[model samples]
Target: MTKPVIVVPKGMEFIRDEIGYAPAVLANGTLYIAGQIGRDDSRQLVTDKEAQFVQVFENMKRVLAKAGGDFDNLVEMTSYHTDMRDLPLFMQVRDRYMKGVLVAWTAIGAAQLCGAPGYFLEVKAVARID
Candidate 1:
């Protein structure tokens, strides 16, 4: 069996050292991504909700790209949202990024996230890579 490869995209600033986890791991043609939040390349949390949603997907995109995959490669996703009412807005931004790349998804409503007061949502994904 091939060993897992930790994927760390260039120019992406995730606090993996402090968090004690890799942002993504590739093994056996599958890429497992850690939960991504709205933090930008500078590590600052985006304030706008819609923009934050976009940032979340963009962050995942970077990890996927590092694994030689794209949105179409995504096979599964699980998202946690602080507010259920934001689903509609989140979907709008998601569709724009996904661009018809469908995947099995589960959305969960949470009272708060780990980095609360700033983070509104988090998304974790799995993708198949050739």
Candidate 2:
């Protein structure tokens, strides 16, 4: 059996160290990326909807890149939203990165995300690494 390889990109060490969870795990050529919030480089939750969406995708990209894949490699994605009305803006930001890549996606409206308020979205995904 192949063992899982933990993929934690630079600047995300706090998640593993302080938060005690891997950002992503790669096993059997499959990469499971943990849900990413709209946190900036300093780990501050983003304020606006559009910029927050961009940061979320950027955070996801870091994990994907660290796991040897890109947005095109994503096979599945799940997004939890605090407000369904923000879907339009979220889709716009998502399309900017996922541009020609077709991946199964599910957008769900939730009461809250990441056990925190002020965060509008959280994105989790699975990717095929070669």
Candidate 3:
């Protein structure tokens, strides 16, 4: 067994220092990314639904980049939504980033999520760097 490399992007010290979890972990050429919420770099949760969705993906992208991967390297994704009805808009924003790159994705409806009340979406993912 080998120790996993913790992936923490620049200026994201809070992921380990405050939040007490690795943003992502790299082991055996695979990156396991934790749930990404709508918080901006300053940690303020985005209120607008559409913008929040985009922010979540941007957060995920940052983690992936820190792990030396990208959306195209994604192998699986699981998204939790507080309001399932927002699926249409969410997919629109997701597709803009996905850009035809397909992965095993599961969309789940969560009652509530994150530290803030308005953080409606959380996306967790796995990607292969090899």
- By lDDT, who's the top model here? 2
lDDT of 3 by residue, 1-130 (tens): 6789999998678989997999899998999999989989888889999999999999999998888888999989999999999999989999998998899999999899974588789999999997
Give me the runs in candidate 3 sitting further than 4 Å from their true place. none
lDDT of 2 at 4: 98
Q: Distance from true position, residue 65, model 2, in Å?
A: 0.7
Across 84-115, the per-residue lDDT of candidate 1 in tens digits comes to 89999989988987998899999999888874
Number of clashing pairs per prediction, in order: 0, 0, 0
The TM-score of predicted model 1 comes to: 0.94
Give candidate 3's whole-model lDDT.
0.92
lDDT of 1: 0.89
Q: Please say which candidate is ahead in lDDT: 2 or 3.
A: 2
Q: Arrange candidates by lDDT, highest first: which order?
A: 2, 3, 1
Candidate 3 local Cα displacement, residue 107, angstroms: 0.7
State TM-scores per candidate.
Answer: 0.94, 0.97, 0.96
